[model samples]
Target: MKTGNQDSSAVKAPDAARAAGTDYERIFHPRRVAVAGVSPGGGVGFGTRYLTSLQAIGFEGEILPVNPKGGEIAGLSIFKNVEDIPGELDLIVIAVAAEAVLPILEAGRKKGAAGAVIITSGFRELGTSEGIGREDEVRRIAASGIRVIGPNCFGIYCPKSGLTFFPNPDLSRESGPVAFLSQSGGLASDFMMTGMWMGLRFSKVVSFGNGADLREAELLRYLADDPETGVIAMYVEGVRDGSEFLDALKAAAAKKPVVILKGGLSSAGGRAVVSHTASLGGSRVIWESVLRQAGAVQVRDLQEMAQACLAFSLLPERVYRGLSFTGGGGALGIAACDAAETFGLEVPPLGTDARGRVEALLPKSGASGVNPVDVANPYAPPALLEKIFRAVAGDSRIDLQILIVLTHHFKGLAQDQGKTIEEVFPYRELADRMKAVAVETDKPVVFVLPNAKRGFPDMDVVEIHAKVREAFLERGLPVFDEIGDAMRAIGHVNRCYGKGETS
Candidate 1:
């Protein structure tokens, strides 16, 4: 996974290395990591968190904890310093105080560390003279051949390498085709967690705060050619070199879809940006124009970003004519039509052949035969739903088909039948049908539970939702909570990649 030519001989600042092309390949695939400033007792200190996170993520690489106290933590012997480590260090995590960062980095460099993730704050964001001077010193040290991720940030998460800032046992370790770079550490975690819930997995994620080193443009260029990454998402505030950033963004977008969510668009947000990462908040209009010209999709929130990434990762690489959906109630179908039109998506009526087939499979009492086909009682047999799925997906007029389930009503139907929802709904069979339809058709097939609720106190409902959603996700089908969000996400991807006639 060589990103580019490695000019390791030329010692240049990360920002100035645009011409030199510093290889960030080693940063994401390190074999041996040393965590400095780990304290005893294994409290939630940043250093301890990194150590535990690596262990919890089942990192196979050698982990060496460093502290001057020379004590054992979690039964691992703590080295007094990185220099005391037995072998070359591929990466080091620095969580010491502001004044203590340089010496640790220097020692790590002496121990042949290729990269360092500085999780310590109190640098330039402090707005103090000493802090500014310290940050400058960091830049100078960064010029000495060692790549850096942050001076005030959460580091990185590479599930393949089992490297994480914070690890969850239940999080998917299987690598997917999405990569994310964020300026805010908190936003990075939020995007990962939310994306996971939405059935989106990432190839790699970086929280590069302050951008003292490892500029966003360099990371963007690296991901552009990365074999594992098919979709790139970014949360940014500003860039140091506007022209270079634009060029890299354009290059990346030309190869794969790029979704950006720019923070600090508002005046108040701008002020917060300066204090948060010491970034310059560019004007919204200029940023929008630049993004549009670069052929990048600019999203407003994490939800939009996640959904757009999912669409790019899952949808077929073909032009879509319009979108259509089935199931749910008539009112929900009406809402879907409204939302689709609002997002510049068309809800054109299904072609006669497809409509005839769907209507035949559905009951005559309350079924909708047109575009947003309403199946009033969605508790019908799995075969009938699959027939409708195949008919709509194979239709010439419709490009994308959404299967809508009003979950509450489905559960009610199960109760009325004196059985559990799983017994009545046949989630496993439906998931198998959806997967089969997706693979057989060139058109995209998506499942939607428009009224899906989160954090339900009823464990039964929660378990059912998890089981169904997980089934779809495991088979490479995306599930959404609302029709509007699903369409909006698909619409953004369509517009960016020159897909549909409308959106």
Candidate 2:
């Protein structure tokens, strides 16, 4: 396990990640970064959105605005050009029009720029020789081995580095092990916010457009060395360099997990990919093989990617010996069966002695006291819940326990404006009971609630989603959107603790 770099103590800041062979901090956590086309108008120029986005997200390092006809963009003074700038440039994110990109890059090269993310589009996507010629020129400039993120990309956002491009994410105070990189700029920014809204922590979010200089493979290699990142998620419309991608993905898998959602699978999706990125849209079978070989999980949807991230994040460093999942409805148990089967998780039925032990403690009518146990009563006592969990999860064979609490009455619990809290559907009692059970069990427990959100249809005054999230965190268990996420966590725990070893 982890044979790539021996010194685990020195993982804080690895020097190899700063070199041409594998360094990504030069692009993501740059010391001196330049925004090549910041505008003069306060918030009216084409680039104002980016300038304001950067400041809004709170980039920590110096953000130099290099504009020939610039005075101020958001009250920040601008320099005339990169030539006039004085210092070592770690990264450059160019936001100028298509025609202005290469020229600004030339200026950036002269200033000792280590890398550049070209946010300008309209080059290779135009399907013209001139566009292709423009791409060639981009590669030529990048020949100095200065890493480039995109010619038509949204750029990267590192919460730890204060590096954000246009369409800056709604950064979260919570930072976790997941890192996301996508070839689709639109998807990257939108997904970042979506993940935040869904209670997910993001490590780094990048949109590597066009990949004229540095492709997905190089970036994968770079993220592998990042200490802050643990789970890697990616969305790809096209691939620029296959060999490099394979190498980087292999290295990354050796370090952590990489989950990907490819835009090209079916014939229709292939056409979409060809149109979106000018990619050739190679055979899907080959792509699948490559993914399996690289040890990356190819998730089906954005929701699945998020779920996979949570699964990979909550998993224990060691493997799990077994799993225990309890559902309120029989249909939910069937769904859990499918989830466990698909994820390669064991769902062994409880033995006569184990079932008898649970039945002895739990309310007779409330729980079936069986594996994939379905408690029949809807308003089952929370005390009964605490008791059953203590008995079933206490069994030494189980390592993870997942509780599915379907609560929609919380929306029904809404009180009229200025009304007292007592006249509401009491969902907290159940949540508290669940938390107590989880803490008592001493096993990692994931909670899933069906059909609840920030502001349900009944009330504009109260946000139930926010309240429940707060409640769960206060109880030391994080609330997930679906049982798929819960099971994924279980699977990851088993992977980590089982006899699996990486070469």
Candidate 3:
């Protein structure tokens, strides 16, 4: 019953995605866009969110809102159909109903639409014959030249182009080196926003649910070729073609680091994935093997993916070996050593010369001159701390240094010792000294403030902690709440870069 054109398109859809002249830029960087099914009253729903988001993100284009019973929204006149709109339409956002989508695509094609983002749901994921038929119709429509993003997705979010899917993303407009692709719309939004808070900016973000037309493999290829994107972060529940996906992943990883968080590895999660996106969840063993063979970093959760991406974005390619830390008690030093060893990082002791240099700066009463060189107190004089840190960095055995400053809890400890907070926690001076050591040393330097607090009744502690962390972050130093997270990120990066060297 299929037409010849539809049959051919179905066969070549994947190839067409990677063909010349057609790429992500045409889809994500559209000049003018039209939104179908936008209500004039500005009530809640998909249509309103897309319209408002475009405006909020400062999308510089002609926004044509289409509605059968429309008059105007936000002082702009709404057209009744795509054909009624004047001039050429680059992109169309179909947000009507499932039954109404085919006709809209038909109109858009007639108007020479470059691409379409189908935001309407109730298709194959509904698990009904009727829904499957509707999805078939969608595929047929997409096969006839126009590219489609999703039938149930948030669509594109390109900061440089001022295009967004949601209002108030709490992210800066400045683009960075990371590009993210997620099958789940909610998860994409959550990860993108959370990554921003952790100082991870993005080059582009796509929430392509179902991926009926533009699937994961195609997206990976496009990102691999993307100049703006230096790193790729992906959250995938399943893939349509395992062989093709692995090929694309390997190709992409060859260009830049690819970090993935694969969901639906378990039986229960696999069933959930089917209902969520109508995907075929692969086995965990096969997935792990493919990831290892493809040279991509596999993470257990979105948080881990974010952490790994940060390391790739910020740190250069280098092998991290010896680990050193300052501050905290002797137990803290032991714990740091354990974490470092667990991640395959070395915790070599300071050399005799370095030990003597540190011993001269620290009080003989409380402090360990060995590795994870704890000064027993974070409030030690900045000059003395600088001497110890420089000596450790100057040592040939050390590759990365961690300065652990107990932020919130240190003020109370200082008060108990009959010393003012300023005398104990000289944040400015400590930051200056850390920055000095970073400049002088050839190794990586990071800060660890475990007791960071926010929005608590203890506003004073929160403010002080924020200030200290900000200082470290401003100096281009990564600050982690736990030593485990810092060590894990470093270990993953070390291994990733290590592979690159051998490859």
Candidate 4:
């Protein structure tokens, strides 16, 4: 599997001809791309799958497939060698064997390609002298001219350019303000899938496996300055340079919200990190200190990270110090207040005028007009909820509002009326009303739709919950499954934008 350009002298040395600056525009939105190591017989190789993924995502770029066998794949003629491709190449997707990667990358550099995503494995992660040597060669070639994303990893997924990761053909093409970077390809893929329903869209998602050339620090700096990226999220097993990473983290966090989920902090996890990415998992205490000093929001898991990203993406860039909670039960109201206090937030009592107005709107019995105004009825109508939300928003001390809607209880109404949950529950009207209240009151309103019944017998309730969640999300209202998650997400926002009070 040799290329036509075997002359090593064709490209300049790494130190002498390093690229002045990375052409991120061309690297991200490439108009012409080449996929190496694609077999014509259509085995499930990385190269072939990537090509199909790009095609499936409606990539409007010229795809040039290369194979030494000189066959065809996806109706494109296979170039026997990289040198035979016409004109300059914008990007190259390399998935050949480890021994063949260096020459292919070198050939791509000679072709004036802007960047390459190396999907082939067996590099430094193998912990072999030969494997390390191969990765070194890849880094050296990358330094000459072309930028590299990975040597043993999944590639980039830019929704704007329709460039997708391997085995992810159904990912959303709608570009968004969120950008994610990860060392583990599987985590990156999983996060992308999770973001689809979680209402977290993305500008760019890169899974730079092995990180031989371009790693976390460089990408962090780039995303900090990227206009398309508003909220940056990262999943790090380890980083190449600790000092550089800290500096980048500080700078990026200063510019925008940077939510990081540090993996391999435990003793057992650290050992796995070495075998997974061939990087060192730093000390937990030091990492925590670094994250705090750098002003980055640190999350414990992917779910928390996703929730933080959702909050940062949707909420205003200010400290939400005070909250107004409205729910169906006093227990939920008390729980909300407790969670709020735990997160350095205040659920203050309403003022005299506001309290009276809110109380007048509630039921005559078993209802309270205090901070967490309990309606004492699960079947509260959307019009009534809207009025209550507006009344609470009128409080001067309240910075934000949370309305807990128990949509599952509507199943009983559906059963009485001989209707489906979807027909009986006015979720669409409720979403529209809540959005209108938020707009009219000039305060963000978060919705908490909790379902206590999720068993197999309650599939209808699950479907209705999903539909209601989507409806709220569509209206730009962040919905959480539980009140605690909502408060925690808000706490993250306050910590990022607030002074020492919320921290």
Candidate 5:
């Protein structure tokens, strides 16, 4: 409930000191976690689901479930109250009704819990006086000691510690440099799911719904100095304190890349946000200006945000000015150039010598070796494509390269050879060659594996394309479904580092 209008000196000295000395490590990597409001009958409520998710993720910590009329759940004894817990709790997840949230929170605070995540709703978002009063009470208890993640949220996801969202049991356990924060639990869950297939591994993800106490600004500052995080992404509807949020954003961006997806910029979306989180979604113009001023990369939607995070997580930190685009078909080449230019990137033509080498290796019938090296054949062999990529990358002006593979077209070849698309297209070999070429040439090569045929008849092709994408991603190459998405992601990287911005 901390607002922009609140004076800085209003915070109690002890509370400020406690906030300053927060045990983020224990909060994120707790050894003992408690879940309040779990059902003894094994129902699918948030608390029960969270307990199951923690188990599914292979959580190596002790889990204590709480319910007033508790028996047992998942072979673990359920405590009747937080006060009845045996020892100090590192973290507590509150999922009881709104009316019962404060008592559990107070008990956890008195038990010396490091933090709490309240999954219960019926907060200020209800837009009712009772709801508002309930939220204020929760905030007051939080201000006394314990840090709170939510009053209506999915809670935190830490890959390193096997802590997952309530509904997310399949999220990746492989930890990486990206940390994401969101006000919407659904968006946070969706992003984590999307990031799994998109080759985005995360360090931590927090959906601080309603953000009763610990929210954007404080979390930003914590992740800024977190050694495990290299890139920060956020789905923000609105912030409590504009000035504090900007300062935190600026500091975080200064330390590492911060990609923001500001929801509710449109009038209707803003109204939805107010109803959703009791937040004030400011004007789009103002948000854009503020993000740019804070030196953050602003994305439009979840897909774009995930793509930007992927680029930041995988690509080198330096900006890429010039690019070498390689693909089949004349139209694809044209599209690549247009997209690159739209993203402030240049597909510079290869040098005379390099162009000659590429042209010599390409088919003489319909191939071009200028910039967007058109092989003119969707079924180009991996060796030939490798030679072409190397030739294009030899240009000193080229800082990066993109190879667009029309993997779906291999279906025709598959049918002709009476084989599956995966059998016919040497995707693994191509991935290996691309990785080698990138290593030898000292230029990163992005892959665009477009599958225009996704109908029922083309399911085989779709499967093969997915395998191909996974292969490339395993080799440390970023893959995109379209050239525009790839360019836009790279463009974000360029805007962050190319302009000498804070990110």
Candidate 6:
């Protein structure tokens, strides 16, 4: 795979980025990373897991440790201050206690550091006198033309160079098109972990923590031009410049989809809205109008937003409007229909002609015969599964079909091995046959596997399922984690790109 361009040739920063494009370049794409108050714990808190994650991926950038503890972390020397580092530092990570950040910032500035990522949490969030003092010190230094990432935040990442501190205990760094920016470090970490299942690699991910200097809007604009980024997935705790944000969104949307998981949106995205953009459109009216006007997709949470973007960036060429489902749950079927409807789909009732094919496929007792062809009863078989789907061969309503696999024998699979034929995932041949039906019929098909709690198989088996979806997607079919995601994708495709088979 072609990695994104690492354009180090300094360009002029937008008037928005403090009129210094060089600053955004140095801040966003760092060559050297420094950790203050580094930990050795294997836990997410701070430890060897972090260093291990970096080294495991073979980060190319330089890493320096600034800890008063004076102990070696990950077998590397831990210096007490940022100035103590050997060469010119591109980024400084402040993980010490909040009160200890100011001195570090001063030291970094004096040393001519390009940027500092403040990972300490107490300040600003706790709203104490000390927190206020910490905030004041950070602002004072940032004012001197040195960029600061957070005073109450976790960290940031440039995966292309292996400078991620957003915490990935497992999963490799070279994963997909996503360039994520968030206010919560935990989400950034977990989103990457979960996203890995679907090949959702990231170009770079940033935890703007408290947004002391490099605010969300500024970061979004920087990513808009970053060649490594294809889709901009943002978790907005707050947007500082509303007009600037709208301008940035409009500009970026022209090239890629801007999927927003706008936090604090209940108060119409309360803290995230008020703190970030200072521009309020009265929650209901303003945001809705803007979203439509901008043609940006707005998702509910971080997972939804990330997954949606992953699908968007990786999708082949077109979005199919056809939908066919073969699952065991009535609620999922109903929910799929309802959600897809909102996305501008025509979920017509399963036709009588199609019902005949389903009946012939698995006997009268085996199929739902209607829209979400519930094909997996205890008596499901390879022949029965294909026959039921053959019913929708003529339905012209939607372009994609969904199969919901209901294998609740997951716990049993744990006792088995990765290659256990009796395990639910070992049914890849059957799944392949289903995929083949879509291929032969020249239709788009997606599958949904329910009963995840039943623990049917190992992650490799799960990977098998993901691979099936990926294949279906690669062949112009849209697959989703939930039937709803598939349905949502279908609707989005029809509206923006037109009704056609999309891989």
Q: Note the Cα lDDT for every prediction shown.
A: 0.81, 0.70, 0.80, 0.89, 0.89, 0.65
Ranking by lDDT: 5, 4, 1, 3, 2, 6
Q: After aligning candidate 2 to the native by TM-score, how far in Å is the CA of 160 from where it should be?
A: 0.9
User: For candidate 4, lDDT tens digit of each residue in 1-503?
Assistant: 14234443343233113433788888889999999999899888888888998999999999999999988899899999999999999999999998999999999999889999999999999999999999999988887788999988898999999998877998888998899999899999999888778888899999999999888888888899999999999998887656667877888999999999999886332434534333443477668878889999999998889999999989989999889998889999999999999988999999998899999999899999998999999888999989888888888999999999898899898999999998888889999998998888889999998899899999999999999999999999998888899999999999998846625
Distance from true location, Cα of 455 in model 6, Å: 7.7
TM-score of 5: 0.93
Give the range of the ten consecutive residues with the poorest summed lDDT in model 6: 1-10
The number of clashing residue pairs in each candidate reads 0, 6, 0, 0, 0, 32
How does candidate 4 fare on TM-score? 0.92
Query: What clash count does candidate 4 reach?
Result: 0
**Cα shift from native, residue 501, model 3 (Å):** 8.0
Worst 10 residues of 5 by lDDT: 268-277
Q: Candidate 3, clashing residue pairs?
A: none
Q: Please write out the lDDT profile of model 2 over residues 63-142, one tens digit for every residue.
A: 88878885876667798888888877888878888888888888887787778888888788788998888988998887
lDDT string for model 6 (1-503, tens) is 12124231222234344645346566666677777767644234453445566677677767777676666777688786677777777777776666677888888777767788777788777788877777877877887868888866656676666766645535466645788888888888877776665457678788888887777767777788888888888887566655566767777777676777766654343443444444454575566567656656777765677557656665544656556666655676778778777776656676777766665665455457677766546335666667666668677664666777654453355446554424544355555676677777767556655536424435644554555555544443444667666666555544445522432
**Model 1: runs farther than 4 Å from truth?**
1-21, 166-171, 267-282, 452-459, 499-503
- Candidate 5 Cα misplacement greater than 4 A, ranges: 1-18, 267-282, 501-503
lDDT of 3 by residue, 406-473 (tens): 77776687679997555567788788878878877867678877875555666767767777877776
After best superposition, candidate 2 residue 357: deviation in angstroms?
4.7
Say which candidate scores most in TM-score. Answer: 5
What's the TM-score of every candidate structure? 0.90, 0.82, 0.87, 0.92, 0.93, 0.72
